[model samples]
Target: MPVPSAPGGAAGPATPPAPHITRRGLALAGLATAQFMVVLDSSIVNVALPSIRRGLDLTPAQLSWVVDGYLVAFAGLLLLGGRLADVFGRRAVLLGGLTAFAAASALCALAPNGPVLVGARIAQGAAGAVMAPAALSIVMTLFPDGPDRARALGVWGGVSGAGGIAGVLLGGVLSQTLGWPWIFVINVPVALAVGAVVLVSVRPFPAAGGSFDIAGAVTVTLAMAGLALGVVMGSDAGWTAPVTPAALVLGLAALAAFVALERRAARPLVPLRVLARPRLAVANTIMLLLGATAAGLFYFLPQYQQNVLGMSPLTTSLTQLPIALTITAGGLLAPRVAAVLGVRLALTTALAWLAVGLAWLARADPHARFLDGLLGPFLLIGAGLGTAFVYVTTLAVAGSAPGETGLVSGLVNTARQMGGAVGLAALVALATATGTPAGTGTPAGHQPNLTAAFLGAAALAATALLLSLTSALHHPAPTAASPLLPGQRTST
Candidate 1:
């Protein structure tokens, strides 16, 4: 029998709610494993692109589809997935998504051609969209509703943050030692295992009774799809392309309508009050900036290392190992850092690292030494990115009402996805705008090319920093926006 407790109690096992996963050790393992598999798929296929292309007889454009398809579907439907998890039941939806994800992985592994692979990846990404937010929301329920949750989130961030880098490493090992298909095949067993664990370990979440906002779901899904399409197509088709502007307008209009409709809906997919919270708002905005600048950082750095500095692809990939490790280290350090330097200062310092690091990288000369020139900024970037992502994510979810976890989680994630697409697209355009002259020296042309992009990324980080200098990040006492830190107590 369930132990009856006061609403919003802050005790150990019943932090906010009684999590059947015990609100402790083994449950966290289940959540983290599920998180890893969902996040790993985002980048696992990148290293296998060449092999996939040859094996599937895919055109460059078709190969691009393999990635873009997944991204669009994942980013577009995240909020819907989150809402479903919260409204229906987290455990049920999570298990369902894991099952679908494993099945999709199987389809991807066995795909015979480009179309099949693209379709399977899209399905896989959609399943991930469902799984990611639900798993995260469950994390919220698993820890005590105070400093414990904050610290646990740090661990969660470390595992989640490392997924992309881990994918690159794993993809290389699996694809080379086995085949390109192994990248997806590996997920099948992992997802199945995660699913089995959740089923056996987790107690069912009661459906939060609510009227289905079917109309709201449709509008937002279309809105996100349109916006993602605009950004994704803007690079290839030109920003002025008919499809791009049309999609943008459609998305913006639908978004506006969705907001207006939500304000009046009996049960909105996302409540308007949640959007009104300053801390949540700024946190998600910072998350967007983090994702954008990070996209530019990763997109350009490896190119500079290989093309300008003359390093082997294998060597360049291996070099990033330090960055990946540093990222995980930073994630683990975030709660401690936030404890010492208040959240705002910590976040500001993290952004400063990005601005300063990227700005430093802009001065990279053609003959620059790897250890002295690149390693510092890479470490700084890795740590800064690690810290920023963890803190921003924590703040993003800090002040959620009982049933709003999935909504907020989805919102922050959607911001990250869209930001990355937009950031990388804009940077690519800037890099390509001034085409390399036929006789330009490698040093002269490549140096400036990479420098300009790095400087732009620095400027973007700086802008975000400037924007971050506000009251939202500061909380001498926990506000309704953020009352879940160690010393903090939840107010009902």
Candidate 2:
């Protein structure tokens, strides 16, 4: 957990990146844009799912793959992506990912059928898994710990939260007016532009050279992919389905194998010691819980607006604008709160706020008004989501050893993505069970008890809130040049 004490803390084998980073502003812009694009693509196609089905003549299962394919690939390969950055150089991996992502997006735009589009989406996700960690590592490199890093992360968090909302809005517009292809087409130009800016602005950091752990990589990647696929299948095909349990069992077996292999591997894909750190463990656990809550909220809230309230897709997007804006505002404000309360307390407060919001949302009904029942809760939930994103990321990344930011970044991202898959699947089941009448099948026009789902999400936030209170998460107060704020000292 030892960190460097100055700007551009540590480099692997190449030249120190700080001296070469003359364009800090531009570098941040490019890195943040890359992250925004990655997050945007995660949800951009949701509104367009129906359109895609009609255009491609896709079956229900195939249509689901268009989304699940991306999630599974992105979640599964994130750890590998981070490890690759550590070994192959962050800039190289980042540029490669951007190039691959752009090409995949282009393929998606031009896809002739459902299978091709699904393949393209998976390619896009794999590329994104590479791009995201590298981009975040560079951001850590550009700004040393303290107020500068905090602010940088806030901007990053803002864009990330906003991207999810913006995707829904943009998809509705583009799919309706232009076509489903336009959604993917837009990414091509954006990815290219971001890559161009990054190429000019960011410096190449040295790679931490070592022999690759092939066995560890294979096992862990398979574990994550299996787990993600299992959750997706359970959501789509019910938990009683044979493949669902089979996939979950396989994933658990692979994960156990991975742990055993890492214990003996000389060059491990992920060092066991790092993950065993008390601070890292606590931070990631809480992040997983928070991620689960946030993902479920985003997935179900729109359905409530559209199905229960009979709002148009565009109207649903518009109604959610306040949530996006508030999330941004909260992210921007998080640094100040952390400066005053320290990372742990700030994160704890954010989770508490989110729990309150979700609990209120559980009270919503079909006749509830937007302003009275939804907007009030949205404001609280959005702010909490934004604030927690900043603090949790800062907490996890702040204490990372030099040259290992990519690995730590990947772990946290993996936690969130995996949590999302689990949360969505579990909530779907909970809602289904609660809403269905005894012995009678769910009839058309009978939506699931989304309120119960909201309550479940609230419980998740509350659990995270409790976890954040753990002594492991405690740290000293921040000040100018304080190592606790991201320098030589471990923040956790």
Report lDDT (Cα) of residue 345, candidate 2: 74
Model 1 C-alpha lDDT per residue in residues 37-115, reported as the tens digit of each score: 7767766665566567667876433555576566556765666676677678888988999999999999999999888
Estimate TM-scores for all models: 0.78, 0.80
Instruction: Using lDDT, give the best candidate's number.
Output: 2
* After superposition, candidate 1 runs with Cα above 4 Å error: 1-28, 46-71, 109-118, 137-158, 161-165, 203-209, 300-314, 365-369, 394-410, 432-453, 471-477, 484-492
Query: What tens-digit string does per-residue lDDT give for candidate 2 at 136-189?
Result: 777776677677878887788667776876786887788878998999999989
- Distance from true location, Cα of 227 in model 2, Å: 2.7
TM-score of 1: 0.78
Give Cα distance to truth, residue 37, candidate 1, Å. 0.7
Query: Each prediction's Cα RMSD?
Result: 6.5, 5.4
Against the hidden true structure, what lDDT does model 1 obtain? Answer: 0.69
Clashes of 2: 0
**Whole-model alpha-carbon lDDT for candidate 2:** 0.73
